[model samples]
Target chain A: MRTTLCDRLGIEYPVFGFTPSEHVAAAISRAGGLGVLGCVRFNDPEELDRVLDWMDDNTGGRPYGVDVVMPAAVPAEGSAGDLGELIPAEHRAFVERTLAELGVPELPDGAAERGGVLGWLHSVARSHVDVALNHRIALIANALGSPPVDVIERAHAHDVPVAALAGRVDHAMRHVDNGVDLVVSQGYEAGGHTGEIASMVLLPEIVDAVGERAPVLAAGGIGSGRQAAAALALGASGVWMGSFWLATEEYRRGMAEASAMQDALVAARSADTVRTRIYTGKPARLLRTRWTEAWSAPDAPAPLPMPLQNLLVAEAHQRISAAGDPSVVSMPVGQIVGRMDRVRPVADIMGELVADFASTVDRLGTLR
Target chain B: MRTTLCDRLGIEYPVFGFTPSEHVAAAISRAGGLGVLGCVRFNDPEELDRVLDWMDDNTGGRPYGVDVVMPAAVPAEGSAGDLGELIPAEHRAFVERTLAELGVPELPDGAAERGGVLGWLHSVARSHVDVALNHRIALIANALGSPPVDVIERAHAHDVPVAALAGRVDHAMRHVDNGVDLVVSQGYEAGGHTGEIASMVLLPEIVDAVGERAPVLAAGGIGSGRQAAAALALGASGVWMGSFWLATEEYRRGMAEASAMQDALVAARSADTVRTRIYTGKPARLLRTRWTEAWSAPDAPAPLPMPLQNLLVAEAHQRISAAGDPSVVSMPVGQIVGRMDRVRPVADIMGELVADFASTVDRLGTLR
Candidate 1:
């Protein structure tokens, strides 16, 4: 299952696993794939630095990466406290009322006060890049397309390749023009913020559009080795998977206290998610729950744009998580959630993917 | 490049082409694939019979199929005039106003009035089946899952197989239990009426669910041979393509007067379509134009349920097509429209698909 991506990234398999948990990322790296730690959950730079230090010690000398979220045009820099004032009261009230109606209690006193909007701000994302480059990170990825030109140059200067997620050909071309080394063509069926193009079309489109400029990694709707083979068949250099890892044993171990999210994910079908702007103030695929359904009501206030929307719901999300109710939790997942019916160790999942890819390829060979 | 579907259908390749034009259907059959002619456009049973006769004569003894639309539960039978009175006045006015705003002129005097809702009704669909069975049709497909049990029995009596389009595992399972011989796993990215799951996920899911009961034909987001290869990798027996054929030379020749639709399609990108209910009262993907965008406005009337909505806008559709303006033409297309950049002969498209599929398989074998 090796491609040029494996040679370029020095990984045994051409698989890139994106996760918010440092433990899962390290496990993926140890399992012969690139483990990309998502940095958007870190409000403080020091927390990310601590996680990277742990990752460096735990990866067993394997290569891993870090992902940061930054909008194309930098928004006005503001602290989490200052950004709280920008959220409309109506939107805030709707969130608060919905949470209370769902019976989600407030977080316990002094529970680390997470869910701040600072992590989404440009300033914090830049700080993430700075901290990631300081560590032995093999790659740096920007979720919302190419980072600023200086950021790309800084990564290149540090001898680390920079990858950007694009949902359209124009975006992929623009990322390459901005000096990105790779393009992760994320599709509409993916978790988190996504564009309207599905991976089946978006991948080949971006691969053809960014021909010879940057390697394209297929993302979204990929859960197994057969899907990975399909990605290569569509002209991708490798496969980038995020949702499939949420059901991994490492993920369950890393977030042991939050079993509700795992329970919800395990019980979900492909049709159980909805695409809405209620998450992160941008269109993202999220598990369809009572919380998301409330926002769909006719009178519900329109979700604010990114950072503000995330700020408004961050506390609500915390409460929903704290409530320990799987039916009302707010989480981002792709359509591949249907196949994540059970938990498996990261190593087992990687082994199964490789074996499946091999057998699928062999089966396809017979047709030829 | 053949699966069990090829042996069962007695076709050379496992490609099932869904098209409305008899000329295109005949070309696909003669070119070695099964061309399923869409019959919903024929409100008159005799018109469909005539087309089947034409297909029988042109297909050169090759196999072809017919597609009909009959909802799960039959609606009350009504004449086109009787159904016309059931459409709300405001809905009628909105369509008229939008047509006028778009400068779509009314049809010329003495032109045949075709956009009747009868084709969508159960009686008309049943008549289509009766008429198709009287011809040399090789298959009968229901766009909205399995047709009536009697319809399935009727097709079997003639030694013709029945195929159904399914979007979910449950739907596919039900189709098999209802005696369907093949299940077309149509995904969210498909043209016309579709389910929310994308083909990348839906294909494997349906294959797993249907097991050995029925062969699944992967549909949606498939335009080229590489995609067809991906479908086979995902466990599908064949590929069912609808939108890719819209750019074929046979289609252009058949609908020569409507070059505007072809022009709009050629200029479109994968992102040029929007999934909405304005077109058919049920959600369907259509080319994003002023017509669809107008319905998205805050004050636009909620699209009436199927049959009613189609009745309300049938004349508007006639006017829009009559006006010969590509900018406002309403057409059903999949995300694959981006790849339909030029018109080519049907045989050429079929040849490329076979060659592409073989090459893709050979390329995948190298990875193994």
Candidate 2:
């Protein structure tokens, strides 16, 4: 079952699991695929280092990687060139006003003093990347676009694969041109930042585009072996699993929150989900909770771009996270959430995937 | 533009367009709410005649009604049912061979030619209420679910309304219920059959589910102002034309294939399109050219379910359509093709819709 990507990543299956928790990452890796720790939410270098070390000690030398969110470019004409400084009082006012209307109370005084940094953004992402590369990371996958030349060079120096997630083929080609070894074609069905295309179509199109030039892994809306077999048929070397993991027993997260996510899964309809900047500063697919609802309202303020959106909602997210209010929190899950029926073990998922793949291949052979 | 659908169909904008020709239905009502069409593809004769004729002429002096392909209900309890008799031996052989290769084909030439039985399916559709009656034909709508009892009775009793089309909530929920006046939510981007989603999110979720509820007027991708605005903001009491009409000064079996529909505006993104079947017996968005080279491949089978997977190749749709060449025939035209650049007239479509019903009202007030 060692596919091209599995061989390259030194894993049994070419499954790449993305998660913020190191435990989940390590679990996926130990289960015979690569687990790329989502470094986007890691607040600081020191914290990431601890988590990486924790993963290292737990995995017993299993290979893993780090995932970042870096775009190839933003409005070069700079409509938002000065993204941070452009945070006018008006935009902040909009956020403030929206929170109030949505019944979101003011941030508890001294909330920041209690725990982590108030938010996660580009800068935080870059710093975390630096931290991961400094560690024994074997690969660096950017969630959005091409990694900077320096990051590409640095990873190459360490002999680590540098990969990028792309919503479009042009973006993947750009990453490949910039020396990216792999590209995860994250269609709209994936957990976070995505393009409008579904994985069913995007995977094959991208696979065709990156043939030999770069190995493309299918992401978004992938959960079962049928979907994976579909992806492979479309030409993806592997699958990047997200929503499925959230349903895994090995996944570490607020149990209640995961339960709420379960509720979301059952009620999951395409219309029930939306692309919004309720989380981070980009267009991401999230559960349509009150938090996202308020943002989507007619009177709601125009959401801040990328990091600003992340900053504005961080505290509210933290509040909801602590309060355990699913409605008020941004639950980032993909359309594939519909297929996640129960919380199972990671190894169990891998086993099912392998069996399904073999069976699908056999079934497909009969057709031929 | 204060055309009350109720006034038009002697009912209200709550009309339905259920004709296989989405653009035609969209155009009628967009000029101030007409009958809905685009249903028969489902092939259910729940109320075939009453639904079809009612859908064709119902919109109370306004256009209404839809037709869907409800062809598969015959195989009840795992039985091929009556449709088996419809399948000629040669056609049956093709299916056996095709299934031997994949699932089913959309427009099997032999099956199409073998269709005295399938045409009888149309007769099944034509059997609604005995006549168009007091229910003025405002709009017609159609889908696969057994035709609602009231759809036939109400449209007849009301003196107007009708609708049809397929594949999603946006298209599925015809303004409130089966009682919709007229609507058609097909997603063919440009043409031929259609797919599972996208007529711009299935015409504003079927114009909040059926047009008459609020005169929901949207097409697969109508391409003009009157098209974009009326349906989107100003109120579709105006237009919804498809890409087919874009080059047709006069409609002749759907305008001939256009050269490269890749202009930036229309290139929206491949994701914007969906592939489904309501035309033949499959589900395939219209993105290919030349018998789609794809359909000719070895591993190109195992399509999804009824009216969907078969739509994948639409049964070598071109084989019979390309001057009967079995190579270049593409069918069905949705609103998405408006991005095709060259303009003809329908009156002048090759056009386009959306909704923010109240805002358009507010904009009108401002203009005043």
Candidate 3:
């Protein structure tokens, strides 16, 4: 169980949990798995430093990682100029007008309302990466795209491994070419935004594509050890989970929120968790909520381009965040929701998955 | 395209292509759109006489249908049987000895020679429904699971429409309970044996499971015109294809196997298809040639379950009927293979499909 991955990240079980919550990262690492803090939401670099310090203090020497968005296909080269100059005025107007028409209320006090979408994401994520790489981070993962060449070089300079998330073979290929140490094949089942491919097929393809160059981690929609095993069977060396930890005791979301997640009947076949630009203006797969419903209306303005989309909805997201409304809030999880019937401790879940995987492999052995 | 499919039998699109090959069914119907032939490989009562005769003689009537095996799940309820009663003492001994020893010739053409791993599939698929129904057969579909019950009832009762081929979703709900027009959410790529689930994601969660309703036509790894449009965006009225046809002057395998099929470099990664038990004694997915070496080793009798794992080296499978050299055989057509690069008589393909389906649907659509 602690074989290959342990050698790579130098962790016990090959479970890397991605979360915005530092508590989760600490808890998982303490529980024998590495929990990487997803850095997109943290705007202040110092906040990241503080969070890392907290994780270090809490995890008691258990190693952890930091994940940021380093997509391989971001605003390609020159087009990235200003990111604003790149978007059409018409598109911008449409997005603004749609918000005006929707009467989405204004943001409350103390909100840092200045530099729009791209500005925020760049400042926050890039800064977090810089801070984490400077700290005791064991790994740095790029969520959206491949890490900029400099980021990879710098991380390498520090002896920290760099990982990236991929939804397709081509995406994974680019990351590998860019020299990612590991490629986390994230399927549609995981929370947040995801590729259309399911875990069953995407894993093997990525594993094959990576060949012997880099280790591969299976991510998205994995809520159980049985699934973790399936990923291994498909050739992934470890499991990267995001949604499974949503219910852990350390998960600080409100009580009602956690209860809804556990008790609600979200069938796998409902219209689908859309890969819409409702969130960061980037394509993301989240639960279809009333907020998303409003934007999807035929009459509503098409979601603004990345950053812009996030800009328009930022306040709404913040309000939901402050208010803790599950009905209209987006919950990122994968298709693996089908198996998340109840909540359990991080250790228990990890142990069960390991045990189940062993049993399943044995079952498959019997077939042979 | 004047291969009138429906007028005689009665349905609509006339795009029938859902079988593993059924004698002359494809040739007969591909001449127009009237008949589609899959599962003719079952070689039972329906094959030798009824299906073949119908395929050869059907006029500009309608699209006829064909169906092969595509499972919503591994070990689909009826897809493969325990065959516990069928396995001869020697076969069991061979299976045991294979694993007990190092490399034993994959399942020794077990005593009965009566049934290979896919042995029960046809009978299970005999789902006479693929053979029943007709109403202009605009399109003949394969209800991969039990071929839609209503198809049989409606086709028989009204003398119109019946279909098969739907790889995932609640097959019981879609093909068994609902009244379908056609349903085959084949993967993104595949030649034979599918269902790891990847029309990226469409194939599995396809909206096919309302029960006793809808005809399903799932063809994976298709290589052709408007296929992406027809299946992904448009929800195909017809499943136009490219694999078997690629081998055909009239069609296009379009992707990897378009030329040498079993002997292409693309076949290595492409041929490790699942939907096991189709050709093998057990269900498994192995590289067309390279990956399967271990299975065929003289002492390694170990194979996967029914159709798949066994599909590679099952001694008794007519598996080599298509590839010839059992050890080097390859079956690489899949949904993603739609990327294959070629074209054939889409018209002949379309014509027969519509023609047979028209007749099939006309015969069945009219049912009470």
The clash count of every prediction, one per candidate, is: 0, 166, 193
**Full ranking by DockQ:** 1, 2, 3
Model 1 ranges off by over 4 Å:
none
As for model 3, its CA RMSD to the true structure in angstroms is 20.0
- For model 1, residues A31-59, the per-residue Cα lDDT tens digits are 99999999998888998999999999999
lDDT string for model 2 (A109-199, tens) is: 7656223232244455667777887777778988778878887998898889988898876787888889999989987656778776655
Mind giving the per-residue lDDT tens digits that candidate 3 earns over A68-152? 8654445432222355465666655655565445454456677655333342354456677778876788999888868887888
Question: TM-score per candidate, in order?
Answer: 0.98, 0.57, 0.58
In candidate 2, what are the lDDT values of residues B1-368, reduced to their tens digit? 23344455542333232334444454545544443444333334444444455434533344444443333244221123443443345433443454334322345445453222232143444443223332334433444433455545665566644444444654456334645444445443435555534332344444544544645544544433322332333123333333434333332224342322322224334443435432345554554333333344563343434423232323333333423331233434343442344434343332122232223233322221
- Give the per-residue lDDT of model 3 (tens digit) for B197-260: 4443343245324323543343654333223222322123345452544334432222232344
